[model samples]
Target: MSLLFAPFKLREVTFRNRIVVSPMCQYSSVEGMATDWHLVHLGSRAVGGAGLVITEAAAVSPEGRISAADLGIWNEAQAERLRPITDFIKAQGAVAGIQLAHAGRKAATEAPWRGGQPLGPERGWLTLAPSAIAFAPGYECPREMTEADLDQVSVQFAEAAARACRAGFEVVEIHMAHGYLLHQFLSPLANHRRDGWGGDLEHRLRFPLRVARAVRAAFPSHLPVFVRISATDWVEGGWDLPQSIRLARALEAEGCDLIVASSGGAVPDARIPAGPGFQTPFASAMRQEAGIKTGALGLITDPAQAEQILATGLADMVVMARELLRDPYWPLRAARALGADVQWPVQYQRAKLG
Candidate 1:
């Protein structure tokens, strides 16, 4: 039997297979509200037979959005809009999950279609971060977050978690990866504050840990919580795999159910050796050293590659982004390619080639 088809349980949530639809931003929301585009986008993956389907990084507050169009759960109204989406995903026998995030200095950017530049008053916004620094030379400089700002952001995370539960989401993954807010704090390259949130490793990790703890506390014990981290900043004098392993262990102790191991994203100048499964080694290392469950992501495209990652125990789960976007039915196709028994939706049964 293929291990990729094997069911895995984290806390009380059980995934029917190892295939997970990694969070891919749609940039299709309106004022942070999920629209029909989100429902169709996510629900199709569930119908395609993925064991887990995670929505894109959802902002915890308005200023936390990566772009003006990113989905959010900052308010009860937004949660209500998400209710049908989660219900649809679960009805298709897939676990519905969400990645809670704050973009920090990366916030208030134009949509990917609109050049992805920083948003100004004309476009409607201001950016905030652990420190006042721009991601790149031409990027907009963000305002430094005060201690009060930090406290408010933490509360925002907790509130988001509560809303997630009410929205019928079974799992919540904290987005600490991809050079966002939490990641900015983790990287010394971005965070240069002398305060408790920026000086050393312990200090840098404090804000993220506090947010995780608060979110975990807000949700019930049975609900699983995961944290996605950029395992390596891919730059000298920046966060690396070893530090990621240590951070993973600490997060586990603080009640994180899994570490979604990804790499790069602290400095735009850092060169990442991009290729198929380029970052799996980081995930492998974290699992071995941190003694915690982890999800390996990054260029994980083929069925054999995903199976190999799980079969060898390099990681507990596999998350694919671009691949899934290319083919929403990738999971179903993978089950067939790997010779695993997975049912097709009744309507599409006649269309199954095999």
Candidate 2:
């Protein structure tokens, strides 16, 4: 049997296959509540046969949102709204997952369709980070976080994890990638502080590790916790693969089940050799050096390519973003392409040609 269609067990949970629905922000929510649109968008992917379906980056607090429209789990009402979505995903035989995130300096931006610019006081709110810095020229500069603020953010992550468990999510992925809050703390380029939360690699990683440990304490041991990290900043003197390996090892010791390896978030101008499976090397290296399981993301589009990734032990799982968006049934098609027998939704079975 192809590894792609084989069962993948992490902690007490087992995925039916290696295909995971990567979290892609929809930028469509009201006060952080998952709407009907979220249901259909995520549910259809589950019905289409993904083994694991992860929700987009969900803010741990309202202020942590990347955009005003980002989904959140800061309150019970938001949790309640997500319950049905999780139930629907499980009903379709997929494990429901959520990516817990805090955008930090990147928060309070308009949706991509609405110019993807920072929000001002009249529209955007103040952003927070390890240090006061804008991601790039013309971007809004964020305020440096105080020790009290750091403590509060950790508590918020713990609370969000508890809420996600209550909402019936099986896997909780901490979004430390994509130049978000955690990334802000991890990247030396963005984090310029004199305190315990910044300076050397150990200090720079302190905040994110603290948040992970707190979140682990909040969730049950059986529930798997995944931490997504930008393996490289793609810039000189920034977060890179060696540091990623160290962090992955530390995260594993702190109960992380997997490291979702990605790259290039701290510096937008840094050149990334983008192509199909551009960042798989990061996952491959982390897995080999740190002895931790990893999920590979970025531009992975074909079934054969995905299987090759798994076959070579490069990554434990293949996470596709745009490919899955283009074809929600990509996994079902992938199984067929790999000559594996995977069930199709009964309603769509009639449409399946021999």
Candidate 3:
């Protein structure tokens, strides 16, 4: 039997297979509301046979958005719009998940296709971070977060998690990766504060961990809370494997169910050795050292490669992004390649391979 097709459970949720759709921003929302585009974009992956389909990082607050068009669940109206999309995913026998995020200093930028530059004052709001730092030279300098701001952001994340549950999602992955708000605090490269929230590793972890605890508490107890973390900043003396392992352990202690191990993005210029399965080692190390379930992402395209990652105990699940975009039915194709018997949608039964 292929491990890739095996069911994996966390809390009361059971994924039909090991394949997960990594959250990729759609940059297709209006005033933080989900549209039909999100429904068709996310629902198709569930129909294509993924075990879990995670929506793109949904900003917990309006100002947390990466771009003007980024998805949001900051209010009840936005959460209601997500209900239909999650329902469709679950109907297709896939677990629905959402990634809660805050872009911090990276907020208020144009979409990637539109040059991805920072927006001017007319179109942008002040960004917030551990310190008043810019992600890159061209990016806007963020305001140093006051204690009140920290408290408010934590409440926002908790409320967002509660709303995601009401919207029918079974999993909530906190987006602490990709140089966003939580990640900004995690990496010394972006956080330069001398206060209790940023001087050392433990201090740097304070706010992110507080947010994780709040989110885990707000989400349903029977559901799983996953945190996506940049295992390393990929910059010297920045956030690295040791720090990530410690963070994973801390998250686990706070009731987080899994760590989705990804790397870099804290800084724009850090050198990352990008290739197939390049990040599995970080997941492997975290699982071994931190003693928590982990999902390996980053360039995980092939079925054999994904299977091997789990088969050898490198990670618990394989999270795919670009490859899944290229073929939403990659899981079905992988089932055939691994000789695992998987069910196809009734409408597509005739196309099922032997």
Residue runs of model 3 more than 4 Å from their true location after superposition: none
Quote the lDDT for 232 in model 3.
94
lDDT of 2 at 64: 96
Rank by TM-score, highest first. 3, 2, 1
Instruction: Give lDDT tens digits, candidate 1, residues 120-187.
Output: 65664677888888888656788899988999999999999999999999999999998999999999
Clashes of each: 0, 1, 0
State how far residue 204 of model 1 sits from its true place (Å): 0.8
Tens-digit per-residue lDDT, 50-129, candidate 2:
99999999999999998989999999999999999999999898999999999998888889999988787677888899
**For each candidate, what TM-score against the reference?**
0.97, 0.98, 0.99
Among these predictions, the greatest TM-score belongs to 3
- Cα displacement (angstroms), candidate 2, residue 229, comes to 0.6
Give Cα distance to truth, residue 162, candidate 2, Å: 0.5
Candidate number with the higher TM-score (2 or 3): 3
RMSD (Å) per prediction: 1.2, 1.0, 0.8
